[model samples]
Target: MAAAASLSVMVLLCLAAVASAQLSATFYSRSCPRALATIKSAVTAAVAQEPRMGASLLRLHFHDCFVQASPVPSLSSLILSSPT
Candidate 1:
C-alpha cells in the first residue's frame, strides 16, 4: 500500500511538471495582442479612482483563482455584479 501511494504521488508530480512546462508567460501576446496593456490601463484607472480598490481587486482575483471551481464564470459574475 505504501509503495503504491508513493508511486501515485510520483506520477502526479511528474504530470504536474509536464502540464506546467506547456505554459508560457507570453501565451496571450499573439492571440490577444493588447491584453496586458488593456488590463494594466484598466487597473491603473481603477486604482486612481480609489486607491483601496486595488486591494479589493486583488482579493477578488485571488478568490477567482483559488476558491472558484470555474474561473471564467466566477470572473464574469464578479464583473457583472460589481458596482460601476
Candidate 2:
C-alpha cells in the first residue's frame, strides 16, 4: 500500500510537470509578437509609479488563482473597468 501511494504521488507530479511544460515562452510569439516586451514595459511603469504595486500584482495573481476559476478573466475585468 505504501509503494502504491508513492507511485500515485510520483505519477501526479509527473503529470503536473508535463502540463506545465506545455506552456512555452513562445506560446504567443506568432499570435502576439510583442506581448512579452509590452507586458514587461507595463510592469516596469507600474512599479515605477508605485514600488509596492509589484507585490500587489503578485498578491492579485494569488487571489485570482484561489478565488476565481481563472486569472485572465478576473484580470481582464479589472483592466476593462472604468474609474468612477
Quote the positional error of residue 12 for candidate 1 in Å.
8.8
List, residue by residue over 1-84, the lDDT tens digit for candidate 2: 556555655676676668755678789999999999999999999999999999999988888767775423343444355243
> Where does model 2 exceed 4 Å of error?
1-21, 70-84
Q: Give Cα distance to truth, residue 39, candidate 1, Å.
A: 0.4
TM-score of each: 0.54, 0.53
- C-alpha RMSD (angstroms) for model 2: 14.2
Error of 2 at 62 (Å): 2.0
lDDT of each: 0.74, 0.73
**Model 1 residue 12 lDDT?**
61
User: Residue 11 in candidate 2 has what lDDT?
Assistant: 74
Using lDDT, give the best candidate's number. 1
